[model samples]
Target: MKLEPVIGLEIHVQLKTKSKMFCGCSNRGEFEAPNATICPVCTGQPGVLPVINKEAIKMGVLASLALNCKINEHSKFDRKHYFYPDLPKGYQISQFDLPVGEKGFLEIDVPTKEGIRTARVGITRLHMEEDAAKNTHSDDKTATLVDYNRGGTPLAEIVSEPDIKSPQEAKIFLQELRKIMRYLGVSDADMEKGQLRCDANISMREYVEGAAPDENWAIQLNPKTEIKNINSFRAVERALEYEIARQTKHWEETGSPNTVQATRGWDDTKGVTTEQRTKEGSSDYRYFPEPDLPPMELVEIRDKQKEMLPELPRARKYRFMDQYGFSMADAEILTDDPYKAEYTERALSELVSWLLSLPEIEGTETEIWDNYGEKMAKLYSGWFINKLGGIMAQNAIDIRILKITPENFAEFITLVYENKISGPNALKLLELMIGAGGDPSQLLDEHDLGAMKEDKDEMDKIIEKVINEHQVAVSDYKAGKQTAIMFLIGQVMKESKGKANPETAKEMLIEKLEK
Candidate 1:
């Protein structure tokens, strides 16, 4: 019997504010020692009250608007009770029912066993919270320690509906969500640096053979289990796959009973999930409204944050096409990566429109063949997306480190248009000149690879000589042998030591022989 999986996600993103939620200490970057980014309030010292950071709210609200969430005009925080080594105050300050935003949805593409599918994941709540400290436990005197530097750091906890049926859906949702966050300046969402954390609960059930729960087709669900401590997208997908298989087997053997609702940690190397402990409910925390901080009224700030919302990817893609006349494929590639988009815009916007207008009016026989115009713009929007931009993003660096200056790349394209070089030769030169100073003239001279095909005067002499020497070729051409002229062009190029431009030589050869 086939089973169905119900999946929901809880994502915690540390906001990219300059300071802690309730203190003036910086929240980003590494600390020199344990508790380096701590203040009296962050360290949970007595007689200290929390001072809310205004910048954190700006980021959260901007992110909410980007996700299409309705911002809560009046929002307050509550205490979540927990006793752990990480919680120095014995509770975490979080928003319980009244969150900063609600009812947001992000659409994601998922690959199912059948085919690709798109799922709209609903955001139940996006609330503000203070982060807990890091804890390392060990048996030996050599190791285990706790770092409180991250404590009291502002974070946004986004809860999503159980609409994601598979791990592929979850992965794509997280990707799109991170893209939104980056565009909004909300958070870095860097998984490797632990700025973004994700947890998910999933359960599988069979299609209910009879009338179901609430008249909906209730797929009979098996005991659901959640895998915790998912730090990477690959891990999320692998752990969910492992959990689905393991849960299915356990149900078939044990007659399908509800496994205890406990949090489990995934062993990535072993590829198995082990039981950690029972999950806690909100009631278990014994929440109460935070008394020190007043409820925030966002009437004044709402409109401002609305203006700060970044254009979403799909919308930006259309704009790229409509405004720049870029192809859909090129626009999608460039806009998906933020740095590339910025680079393209910066390069294109700086150019004068008068320079661009020359490309069409100037005939191909004139300076239009020089690629003096449109070369830089084409590189910015079209070729740079996949070729240059992708390589930089993969290395986790900015566009500045991409080696070649924009001026040099423009020169290379110009050379290609001037028919000074062929496409293959241009690419070969680019590989050599990318990192260092790549002046087209210097490189062409050093490599002796420039197109000599356009020397019509010299190629004409060779073309005439070839026609005279090859009576068979001329006879063949007279007999309508098109291949005979091509043979003569090749002979001229070889005799000129490849300095004769092949294109010009071909035209001259065709003119003489065909005549």
Candidate 2:
């Protein structure tokens, strides 16, 4: 029997707010000493009342808008009963049926051998909730420790429908979702820091070959295994892949597709999932409206948040491609970080202005862009993404802390575009500008790194000297060895200390050698 994996994800995003969801405790508990940020309300002391954090609600609404979720005009918090060492109150305050948002979807682009395939994963609901405290177990398994400081931290639980088809789709969905959250300025959504976490529910459904699951009436839903403790996006993909294989093997061995629903923990080290416990149903939680907090009227808040929504990642990516003539790959990278995207746009604008001011170029703004947009855009992306990005990575520098301003970056790119400096000299000038924060032109002059191509007479003399010194290479070129000219050009650049443009030297060397 042919089988397919049905997958859904429940993502919990910790909102970047100043205080806990139901109290005034500092929300920066992840950085503080354990239990330092806890207070009576968040720690669930008896006789203490809980006050909702308005800022957290605003952020939740903003995120929902970004996700294209329809906001619920009215919503309420419920007490989710559970017993755990990390739960100080013996219950969690979360949304039940009436969540903050619902019926949204996230679009992801999956690359295949054929081309880019776009998939829209449906979002079931996004609810407001409080986070559980951190649990630490001893190495010997003798004792456990709890840190209540993280308790009551504001969280947005985004539940997705079983729309994900494969493990790669799941990973891409999560990545796109994280980018949206970051673009909204609501949260960093850093998986390593525990701000954004995912629990995936996956099951295998038997299907006929070449038949759609929806069209096949014989297809039945198998019990799903909810995989938890997924720390990273890669782990989510790997864990789902492992589970699909394990379940497929079980079906073949037992000759039965029916299995008990369970919750499992992903062991990243062993690359397998271990059964944690049987999965609990909603009824098991005994969810009831919270008595301490009143129901919320979110219509006003939703309207206000809608007005505050910024351009999302997907929209910005498309805009970058359409406006700047950037390739899809380049646009994705440029728009992945909001700060980097802004920097790229500003630098491109400066480049356009500088190009228009050039004496040799004469055209309307649109005409000029239509003529040179793609070429200039490609040049800028190569330097920004490959060259400059590599340098920043080598120095362990974040784009936010980059010392090179967009204007200066544009000027440097202009120098390269106009062939004012050779490639090697351009690289050296860029490094200097990055280190000392000087103008590209000034750095070029100070370091004597200007391209030697502008001085035609001086370049001719250098080419003559290189031809005389490399008699063997000159003979090879004269004897129809086409690649020997490259060696002569290398000597010219070396003799000129990398100031000579290779293209100019190649032309001069070929002319001199042919003569």
Candidate 3:
């Protein structure tokens, strides 16, 4: 029988607030010594009342807005009963009935057989919670160690609906979620650092071979296997793919079993899922309102957070395409990182201002501003995404640490736009500006990398010298050999100490040689 995979994700994002969720302990425990940043509240000492971090709540609301979730004005915390070495209180304080946000959606582009298609994944809830401590077992399995430093860390648990149909879609959804969180400045969402973690609930069902089933039957889904604590997006995709095959085989052999849902852990090294325990239902947690802390009034907070939100990635991407005429692919690349997007915009703005201020020596100022947006978009995207981006990748330098200011980069681009420098010379000047942090024009002059002899008289003299030196090539060019003209142009550029613009020299050579 044909098979269809049903998948959803539960993502825990660590808020980048200064302190823990319910305690004042520092949240920078990832780099500190084991258990160095712990406190009584975090470690769940006797009779210590927990206070909510106002900043964490604000961040959560901001994240909710970014995810397109509806804010719950009165969300209360509940105690989730569980027993584990990582749990100090034997119960985690989280939201049950009332979460901060609900009914949101994230759209991701998936590579389908046809082409790239956009899939909108639904978010069920976005809840605030505290993280459990770390557990490490020894090599001999004789001793287990627990670190409480990460306990009580503020986390926003985003639960998605079963709208994800394939492993690839799931991965893209998570990646988009990470990008949104990062853009919001609420979370770094770095899986390697445990800032963002994912758990996937996946199952397989029959394709319903013939006639449409009844409403009740259509709503029926097979038993789901929850894969716990997948650290990376790729791992989530791999694990889900494996589970779909495994469950499909099992269903073929024994058919769908009506039993308890299973929770399994992914062994990334072995590339398999091991049964951890039966998945617990909501009733199993026995959640109730926390007696210590009162429910929050977040209506005003939500309004404030919505106002504080900067332009998100998707909106900014569409704006780039619509307003600046960037292609979808180019806009995606530019907006993938917040800093790079910001840099691109700043550089474009400065370039436009500079372009409009030009003396109109060659072109009309009206013409420059009329199509300046599209012109600047292409120019900035080409150089920044390809040329400068490639250089940074080769040198392993972060864009944030780049020495060239956006204004200086705009000026450098102007030099190229005006054909004041040759490509090779412009690249040389760019390297100097990036490395030494100086004005592009000044550096160009200091390095003598500009087109040599801007005066037409001087250029004509140099071209005449080249034509005289390469008489055979000049004669060949005059006899209708186009290749010989390029040869003469090369000689002129070399004689000009690599400063002669190839285009200018070629034009000058063609004029003199044709005459």
lDDT of each: 0.74, 0.90, 0.86
Q: Give me the overall lDDT of model 2.
A: 0.90
lDDT of 2 at 142: 98
lDDT of 3 by residue, 1-515 (tens): 68788898999999999999998899999889999999989998998999999999999889988888999999999999999999999999999999999999888877768977878888999999999999999999999999998899999999999888889898888888888998999888999989999999987776766645343235567778899868898999999999998888887888673256999999999999999989899999999999888999999999999889998888888888876679888998999889888987888788767876766533555466556667767877888888888899999988889999988998899888877787777877878887988899888888877876577888888887877677898778778888997788778777777777888888777777667
**RMSD per model, one decimal:** 6.7, 2.2, 4.4
lDDT (Cα, tens digit) per residue for candidate 1, span 1-515: 66666788899999988888988888863545787777788878889899889988877787777777889999998889988877888888899888989998887656568865667788888888999988877778677688888898899988987778788888878887877777776777899888889998888776455655344334444445778988899999889998888777876888674556768898888988999988776688999999989999876777998876667876786777766667666776777667667766655443323344555556442244234434544654544654555545666647657666656655565565567875445555666665465686689879886877445676667877888888898888789878877787777766765556667777777777656
The C-alpha TM-scores of every prediction are 0.78, 0.95, 0.86
Q: Name the 10 consecutive residues with the lowest summed lDDT in model 3.
A: 210-219
Residue pairs clashing in model 2 are none
TM-score: which is higher, 1 or 3?
A: 3
lDDT of candidate 2 over 447-475, digit per residue (tens): 89998658888987888888888899989
User: lDDT of candidate 1?
Assistant: 0.74
Error of 2 at 474 (Å): 6.4
Question: lDDT at 346 for candidate 2?
Answer: 91
Q: Is candidate 1 or candidate 2 better by TM-score?
A: 2
